[model samples]
Structures are given as C-alpha cells and as structure tokens.
Target: MTAETQAAPVVSYGRLVPVVVHFDDLDALGLLHNARYPVMVERAWTALWHERGFGFDGDWEAAGDFCNAVKELRIGYEAPVNRPGAYAVHLWLERLGNTGLTYGFRFCSADGAMTYAHGTRVLVRLDAATLRPTPWSEPFRAVGRELLRRAS
Candidate 1:
C-alpha cells in the first residue's frame, strides 16, 4: 500500500468504530498514560465482537470462550491526548487465522490534527476450560473471515 493510501489510523472499507475515552485513563501528566493503550485495545476487541454479533460479555471466564492470549502488541505514539473528551479509535483486521487474529488500530485525537497512537495486535484463541491454544470454531472462522473482507 502506498503511504498516501495507508495513512489512516483505521483503513477499512467497513464502518469506522469509535471508542470514547474515560476520565480515569489519564496519568499525572493529564494525558492518557502509555499503559492505557492495551486497555483500549481490549475494549476495541470487545466492541468488534459485539459488532460482529459474537456475544462476549465481561463474563468470558464464565462463558468458556475468550481471547485467552495476546501473541503480539506494538504501538507508536505521535501526540499527547490530555484533554477531557471522547476520542475515536479505528480497528481493522489484517490477518484472520484459524486459531488467531491480527488487528491494526489507529487512535485519533479529539481535534483530529495528529494520530496519538497506532498498533497491531495478534491474539490466540484458547479453550476456556483447558486454557490452551485451539483452532477457532466454524462460526468464529466464518464471522472473522467476513469481517476481514471489509478491510481497506
């Protein structure tokens, strides 16, 4: 992809989802701390699940289905988000494997001048009971594949 075409934080033909910020996410500097990046990712993952109609409540441990492990996480920060307001987060699927998924994220500032952060994450699916790596079920594979098709 050319730099011009790949510039967006979330570049998918599908809808660009938004994730609002929380007051408690701030650090002493008033901007969101670096540690909160992963937390936002988890939320984005959950939001994606809901958007796809795959029900995953906060009760993953009790439901016997979950994103059990993260294989990789990388982020780059370009600006500080210290203001108190809702921010937009974009997510897209790069690779959807049988037992795992890779995601790309772009965090846009409220003012939309700079991209505060961008990242890619790989996660492994696991059996809720065994807590071990396992291939995705048919429904999951299908849903994930459909989602990836919308990627720009």
Candidate 2:
C-alpha cells in the first residue's frame, strides 16, 4: 500500500472529543501556545474518561484505571490555531500492552480536515500503593479495546 493509504487509517477510527481554545490559552503571537497543545489533549482525554465512568472521585481503588503515568509524549505542529473557537481532539489506542498503552491523537478542526498538531502519548499503569508499573485491569483493557485500532 502507499504511504498515504497507510497513514489514513487513524482518521477513520477512534473518537473525537471537542476542545475549545480560549483566548487565555493564546500566546503573544495570537496563536495557541505551544505548551497548550498537550494540556488540551489531556483535557480531552479526561473528558472521555469521565464519560466512560472513570475518574478520581475520592476512591483511589475504583479509579485505578485512571492512575496511569505518562511514559512518553510527542507532538508535531503542522499549523497554528489562530483563533479561539471550537475544535476537536481525535484519540485512538495505538498499542495496548500488558502494563501500558499508547494513544495517538490529533488536534484539528472540528471536521478534522485541518490538523494543527498530532502526537502519541505512552502511559504506564501503576500500582496505587507501590507506585510501580502493574498490569492493566480487565475493565480498563475492555474499554481500551473499544478505541484500539485494527490492523490495516
């Protein structure tokens, strides 16, 4: 297959979480601050988690699936978000391992025709008490499988 075909699958899968770029998030140049990209993506992920009934609401044990730590993050900017408006962050499971998973995301226009930034984040599940890597719970893996991309 061609490179274009291979790269097109991500956009076809996963979910789109809405994001609003407020004026406060802009830099002096009137563009969304470079640092805000990850923050926005994080918020999107949090919202998704919440919608899926996973959150830290004083019950650590119940929220263990949301306790993963970022092992890696990579973002590539393709265009600048020049105005504060409605956009979207597309998220999909890239790789789901025993103790960790990698998510692929794109910060783009609401329709996803214009991509401002794209990246992947690697998160390692942790043992709440020991703070060490631990296998993902079955419930967590089940939810993850819904977002997991199928082989092209």
Candidate 3:
C-alpha cells in the first residue's frame, strides 16, 4: 500500500475508540490506575470487532460461538492523565497468524498530542464451549489482513 492509503493513526486504524475518563478510573495518584490500561485496551478491541459486524454487538452466530483469548500482552507506560476528560484508544492489526492475531495499540490524547501508553496483544481464537484454540475463519483472517495492509 502507498503512504496515502496506509492507515492514519487518527483515522484508518482498525478503529479509533473514544474513551471518556470517569472519576472512578482515576487512582489516588490522580492518574489512571495501571490496571485500567488493560481494561481500556480490551474495550477498544471489542469495539473494533463490533464495529466490523462480527462480534457480540453483531451476528454472534456468524462468529461461530468463538471467543478471543489473550495469549500475551506487553505494555509500555509513557505519561499519565492528570485530568479526567476525553482520550482515545487506537487499535490496529499488527500480525496475523494461524489461530491467532497480534494487535498493536496506543492510548493517546484526543488531539494526538501525547501518547500515554502503548501495547501489543496476542489473541488466540477459541471455541467458546470447548475453550480450545481454533484457527480463525476466512472472514476474520481477511479482516485482519486488510487492517494490517492499511496500517502498513
């Protein structure tokens, strides 16, 4: 893909999900709690899939009663949000593997001034009932590949 078609951090990542920080999300230090980062990441990913019409908010049956389980996660902290207000989480497909997908993301200021945190997560598709790792469906793989291509 040409630079023009490459995913822009502000627009073409898998999804740009807004996060309205709540008072409850803050710790006594006046920053978002360390644990909250993962939660936000998870929420953003879920929203991405939902927006693509393949998750809980969409045709669940078409998803084949499968769920994604995190196989690995790594995060790096940058600055902290001292004020509670609007922020955003950027999600994009980093890598696609048989039975798994790796997503890269960042928590940034609403205007892209600062990146508060960044991370990558490896998710394995699993049969909800069996809880056994399963290969992703063609549609899912295609979606991941497309995101990767756009992000390239």
Candidate 4:
C-alpha cells in the first residue's frame, strides 16, 4: 500500500507521512536496505504534494511542462531499520529558489524511539519536453514559501 497521509495534531519540525515497510524492503541482513531510503523519501515527497492539492492530473504541456525532478539527494543512515511495520517520514520545505526547491527529511521508527535516517533533496522545476530547468510558477513558489515558513 502507498504511504498514508495524516493531519498532524501539532506541527513540529515538518510534515509527517506514514510509511509502510514491505517484506521485500529488507536486506539479506534482515534490516532495511540502505538503497531503499531514497525510494521511501520519494514516496513521502509525492504524498506531500498531493496533500497540498497539487494538480498532477492535468496535461503537462498546459502546465508549462513543469514537473518536479530531483536535482540532488543526500541521505545519511544513522541506524538500522529491522522490523517491517508502520513508520513515519517527516518532510519539510527548506528553501525555494528561482529554479529549484529544497526539502529536508527524516525517517523515524513507528514508536518514535529511533531515527533511522535523515537527508535533504533538491528538486528543480523542469520543462519535460526539453528536459531543461525552468523557473517555478508564482503559485508554486507561493506554496513553497508558505511551507518553508511553517517549517521554520
């Protein structure tokens, strides 16, 4: 199943998305595969956009062919994730530039006892047709700015 979105009773460091660890996500060592962290983060990112009511169903060209594409991603593993269950992936807007957006993220255990990993991802708005970076739309920028402010 996809990560579930929930309303935070109190907004803390960032927004939280519920992550489900599938059986296949574990490595041979019985812990979450290191490479899977990025995948999980991507899922959380998509959920974040959807939660904010981003229109992703319309024609890409009509929307100026703008799409969010990861320009860079860096993840630091702090602890091993062994059990397969519900977890939380916290995400927040870190910055919004003319042609990019940065987001901070964290992976925590189900009970919040351990922090599995943390990282930052830089995303750029791209013209899908030409595969070139493009400036973000005013509406998109406004939403990003609001998220960043709330994160602070």
Q: Per-residue lDDT for 29-128 in model 4, tens only?
A: 8999998898998887777776666656667776541476777988999989887888878777888888888888888865445679998989888886
Ranking by lDDT: 2, 4, 3, 1
Q: What digit string (tens of lDDT, one per residue) describes model 1 on residues 1-152?
A: 33212333444432344556678888887989898877876776677676666666677564433646888999999888786565656666778887788878777753334578988888888877677888877777776665574522
Q: List where candidate 2 sits over 4 angstroms from the true fold.
A: 1-11, 58-62
Per-residue alpha-carbon lDDT of candidate 3 for residues 69-117, written as tens digits (9 for 90 to 100): 7889999999987777777787778888888888888888765558999
lDDT of 3 at 18: 71
**Candidate 3: where are CA atoms >4 Å away?**
1-14, 57-66, 149-152
lDDT (tens digit, per residue) of candidate 2 on 60-135? 6666887779999999999999999888888999999999999999999876788999999999988888889989
Which portions of model 1 miss their true places by more than 4 Å?
A: 1-11, 57-67, 110-113, 149-152
Inter-residue clash pairs, candidate 2: none
Residue pairs of candidate 4 with colliding backbone atoms: none
Residue 50 CA error for candidate 2 (Å)?
A: 1.0
Would you list the rank order by TM-score, best first? 2, 4, 3, 1
Best by lDDT: 2
Q: By summed lDDT, which 10 consecutive residues of candidate 4 come out lowest? A: 2-11
Clashes per candidate, residues 3 or more apart or on different chains: 1, 0, 0, 0
